[model samples]
Target chain A: MSDSDAQNLREVRAIIARHKLGDLIFLVTGLLVLMIAVLTFIALFSHMLIDGLPRLSWDFFTSFPSRRPGSAGILSAWVGTTLVMIVTAAAAVPLGVGAGIYLEEYAPKNILTEIIEINVTNLAGVPSIIYGLLALSLFVHQLGFGQSILSAGLALALLILPIVIVATREAIRAIPVTIREGAYALGATKWQTVSDHLLPYSAAGILTGIIIGLARAIGETAPIITIGALTFIAFLPPSPFKEEFPYISFEWLMAPFTVMPIQMFNWVSRPEEAFQVNAAAAGLVLVIMTLTMNALAIYLRYRMRKNLKW
Target chain B: MQFPVTARRSDNTPDSSTLGYNYRRHLSERFIEAMLFLTAFVSVAITLAIVVMLVTESLSFFKHVSLWEFLTDTQWTPLFDNAHYGILPLVSGTVVSSAVALLVAIPMGTITAIYLSEFAPFTVREMAKPFLELLGGVPTVVYGYFALLFVTPLLQKIFPELPGFSLLSAGLVMGIMIIPYVSSMAEDAMRAVPMHLREGSYAMGATRFQTAVRVVMPGAFSGIAAAYILGISRAVGETMVVAIAAGMQPNLTWNPMEPAATITAYIVQVSLGDLPHGSIGYQTIFAAGLTLLLITLVFNIIGHLLRKRFREVY
Candidate 1:
């Protein structure tokens, strides 16, 4: 063989060797990095649990915040969180589902519908804190709802509404057009077909989406903090029950509230060692709440994918 | 051939009764349709309301601080008596931290995506995805705590002179928080690349890694770019971690080790205090909010356009 041809063959072999080495390095590091990341996550959770368990007790979950770390509890925060979540779900769920139904089932192929679609998409990605500013201007001040659970819940509702709407629309869109056509051929009206076949089929997907949205909302601190949710809510909002006429009260709507995340934030900011432990415990609780919701969503999605024929 | 009419139902029920039932059903349908339309219009209304709220408040802010100085000034000391209205400090802080976040996130997240899509078995992919998402969904406040209490300390050990609250901690945690978003989106894009292309690469004597890196990555570049842009947008607007760990000082520095205030952090700082509505302090935060809004808006629009372009290819 000529010397140049010999050189070319050698270079090709060298290149292949280099590529094979590179491939091994790439595979090893790729798996290693993900492994480290996930292990760190587990470590972080364990750290929280270890640091927090000593501080956990019946009293820790029952009493209100106090000057002493030992006596301080998440009672007010959890109660306020539940109350706000109630209002948020009440407002957001129906509106989001209806909008999703309309966009998927009813919207015409026109610019208006496209605008609505883009609007929802943009809103879904807007910084949650900007929703806070919007809530501050529109609901709390302009509407004179004051700094109350009603305002906080309404703000969260708006924040999560886009998420819910997007999820619902995706679910509805997944149903075959032929399925709807069959319903139409059976003389079912548009609304009837939607309320019966479409809604039932998509319910698992839509519900899972809503739960995910709500989970995100539960973890939200920026918007709630922006709406000026009291960082140190001492007393719970007045009971919705009353002794007088009308029997039920809306007074709690205007009462100030704090949520689990905000309370944890406040504790984390404190310089005291005891408060940091308190923060860890509260963090653990919040993590539990969020993970449960996510697990539910994942399970629902898996079941829906498996059981559905199409 | 004409189809049999549903009007043949008049054989079972009176024609007038059938007509009445159809009319009632039509009215109900119209009512329900109108309600649904209004529901959908709520999103449109929300978009309008956000724009109006930001503009109206920002106008009041501009009245107090000239637009020229507001944009040009280097110092952002609005809370002090000698109020310098320059947004450079805040913008610089945002830039330094977000750049750090992207530097860490883009590589780790993309690598994770590649591993999951190209190498991992189905069970491994399924198991890893949920954990990644869980990591993503951990509240920012919790992350803020982790940064301030844990990450900053770890960095201080490494650097010995790192500040108690530095952009490094906040930026790193933000990177960790954003991994799921980047990886998941990019993975979906990479998976969408046609199988034939990879098979073709193999037929050409290319290694799987070579096919993935050279062919699949470039094919999915638009989606990856879009994912990265959205990830940057999120890191830019993130508030809690920066507020807690990135230091409260709005110093105009390029150093990630130094504490700085992002636009979101500044707004959070102002809001945490009881700033009265229409006051200059409140207006300033509104102005900051507007700036943050515009930045994210630019990124979102670009990402959307790129994704749209990608959709046209196949």
Candidate 2:
């Protein structure tokens, strides 16, 4: 009787084992898929480091692009990149934050606000090249800004405006509903509550969004390219100061510019293998800048989440 | 008159208005609210301006090339010595690359999502997500650089027949670029599945893997589909990687090994070239851009609708 029972259990075990095989296969496949992504990224990063390390020198950072690969530096490129970023951040942050505050607080729950919400969502996903088209027509020709840093910055601001708005909204939403109600109870105006209480409370989160959005703006190449950012720029933008009493100058904004990504694009498009090495170095710098920005944003978000109990 | 009367009537309230504080505060508040509203309206204006800009330019372009001919034309060589305005070449190229990307991204991303949502330990999931997002944060131009400088060489070793610049590399790398997008969105959806449902599945003797695939995945299908479609739209609009790795020549062929030009790539090419502002050559790009925008807008709307539908259900 005992032997028969053992045999029946063995048969049941075999049946269960067959079903378990699918689970193992599925688990392994999932791990393998994730591994593929991790490995490809590793390979890409390491390859850039290897190719670019030799080219990273003081001269490389200080000088401008040259005809020879050995002499070409990213001075103009980095400066232009920074300037464009400054412009984009300046343009996008306040407007996006204001829009976000209005959408979340002041606007009534209605169809027109709904349309604005949808438009922002839709704009966030629009092919960046389309923004370039808009800029080319509206900014470059219609307004006659031409292919300048201001135009490129304005274009990127549009491209990233949706991102900033979404991030700001998410950040402000994380603040408790009770907080807003408390402001209302205090007889504070809506704007006062937002500017004094909400903005200060969500400042870190808003900064995080602005940083991430700027990080995204810095990495973008497509829209700027469409607006005719050059590959061969060797001069700095006009100085922002003058010999006159009024030192500040706005003319630099109108000057032609080429950002790091555009510079990389320019070099990488060359037929020469040497230029590819040049591209790698520029790519490395851009990657480092972008990654640091993202890491800072992530750290800010993590800290904000962890430290806040309510 | 009403403001001063109300200010004086409320004896319990502080008489700040007598010192001009209330008046100043009221004015500033109104000004700021209006300012914020105006800022919000700017975004709406930007959208309207985009539509206006594209349509007006496209209308002028259509005067030269009929809409039917532009749509039905089989070649797209506006820069060539003999011009052709057919958009099929660029459209096919975009479709092929996007298709290849989706085919690679969907299974890979979904599996990773399932594992992260249902199987991975907390530490592993936490560490993995940021790194995956970092991949997404990497610029498309960098992806393009990788595709041109590294991936093409790697693929050439395997296929031996693959071109230096082909849709194969761009599409595959673009898939990798989109993995975080798909996995993160899908994982969010799967995680949103009520824990009770998983407990119910477990009580019925279903394994975690079985429950994930059979129970949670179906419940999250709308979000997953939305994510997949959004990824497709991204791949379609992607410019740098395709423009860098895919060739400039417009080929309508479906073969990945062969070179093709995407709509974004065509726009890049034309803009990089010198053309007069008002000429047909310049106008041609706007028309192409209009087409690209419409195509992406359709997918985006569908994805949005699906997400809204999914949100309602939850």
Candidate 3:
């Protein structure tokens, strides 16, 4: 080979090496970009834990809000959150599941079905605060639910209805067409097939969806705040038990309440450092609650995918 | 039922009673179907209720304040004695914060997507998935706290004159909070691009980076645009971060260093205070909400269309 040809070969190698360097630089940059998210997660969690760990105690769970920062606790808030969650689950599960079944199995492919599908997708994107406005007008005023636990529960029920419906539909869709055909060949009616086969098979997915929806609802502060949930409640809602012949009571649903997030918001807005500590503690609890639910959903999804054959 | 029975008898088959249809079961099935249909219709009812509520309340608001003034005025002090019902300040604040957030989220999110979709090994992808989910799962209020206590202090170290509650801190935290959302969606879009396209790029002697950026990105452009639109919607609608960290003072400015209120933060601030129903203060929130809904709806529709287009293409 000539010396000039050797020089051309060397230049070609140099150009290829330059491109490889660019690739290496981007790979590092991409990893660093992704690390921003991971690092933020660590920082936020540690920040809350450090600020809040000392505030966690048995008494902290048993007491109520107070004028004094050191004495205030989350008793009313947690109880309210629990009750609202119960109401939310009760209202959302049946409606969302039923809707999912209808859309997936019953509804004909027509204009109305298309409209409903589009509406559900768009509803998922509506801001949570707007739901608050809807509740404030419709439930608080027009329906006279006031700022009660039932109103807040119903509001969240509406907010998460789309999520549950989507999850349920996706789960139902995953079941093979052969299952439906087999059910039909067995002389089973549509409802019978759905009850025996479809609903049973999709139960895990539906539960995961419910847990996720409830988790999202639990941390939501804006809608509850917009519906006029009090920030400084010192007493819990009336319990759902009676000492009379009828042992179940419904009065608790109409009682005013404050949730965990709202309580944190109240404390965060306060002008004192002690209150900030309380807020951080409450935030830590809230984060744990949501993260645990999401983790459970992920685990359930993994197991479902692993266990199912078709 | 009659036709089937007569035909069977005419053909000299066995009595049809044994195979007769059960009308009771049929009726019950119809009832259940109707019930489920109603359940599905509830979502439509919700959409109607939202539009109606916002419209009626905003109608009352516009009754008192002209639409032109609400659109063009620079001030937005509805609670004070000298009330000016301009929405520009809130709009400007929302715009600036969302811009700041997108500036951080779009590039970071796109690069993260490229890395995850094109380059990450299996174990790396598995580990990173949960990290992203956890990041997305963290509550906005907690993010608000972080922005207020951690990020602001860190920023203040670099720029001493930065206020304790500036949009810059809140916007940055908001961007970090949004990273998981943007990256996951964009990654899904890029991964959906067929493997043959990447192979073609590789066959042409292109590097992995070149294939991902030049071939995969262009192939997935519509889907990525949809993801960016979603990130924008989330930023615009985000409340607690700006409410907690960015001061709720509605200032008409584009500078991220100065404190201002986004439409969401403004609504939260008003809700935190007591304003009687039917009062102007109350009505203002609805008007602001209507504006927010309109903005997000536009983005959502565009995103939905883009998603549909990309799904069809692939």
Scoring only the A-chain of each prediction against the true A-chain gives TM-scores of 0.94, 0.95, 0.97
**Model 2 score (lDDT):** 0.88
DockQ of 3: 0.61
Q: Which stretches of candidate 3 lie over 4 Å from their true place?
A: B1-21, B305-312
Residue pairs in clash, model 1? none
- Strongest candidate by DockQ: 2
lDDT of 1 by residue, A220-272 (tens): 99898888887887888999988989999988999989999999988988889
Worst 10 residues of 1 chain A by lDDT: A36-45
Least well predicted 10-residue stretch by lDDT in candidate 3 chain B: B1-10
Would you list the clashing residue pairs of candidate 3?
Answer: none
- The order of the candidates by DockQ, greatest first, is 2, 1, 3
Residue range A1-310, candidate 2, lDDT tens digits? 6998999999988867876887788878887988899999899899999999999999999999999998999999998988888789889998999999988877778898888998887787788999998999988999999999899999999888988898889888899988877777777766767888999999999899898899999999999999988888999998778999798898989999899999999989999888889999999999999999999999999999999877
lDDT values, one for every candidate: 0.89, 0.88, 0.91
Clashing pairs in 2: none
TM-score of 2: 0.95
Using Cα atoms with residue i matched to residue i, what is each candidate's TM-score against the true structure? 0.95, 0.95, 0.96
How good is the docking of model 1, by CAPRI class?
medium
Q: Quote the positional error of residue B294 for candidate 2 in Å.
A: 1.0
Candidate 2 Cα deviation (angstroms), residue B206: 0.9
Q: What is candidate 3's lDDT per residue for A1-310, written digit by digit as tens? A: 9999999999989988998998999989988887778888889899999999899898888989998988889999999999999999999999999999999999998999999999998898898889998999999989999999999999999999999999999999999988888887777778888999999999999998998899999988889988999999999888899899699998999999999999998898887999999999999999999999999998998899899998
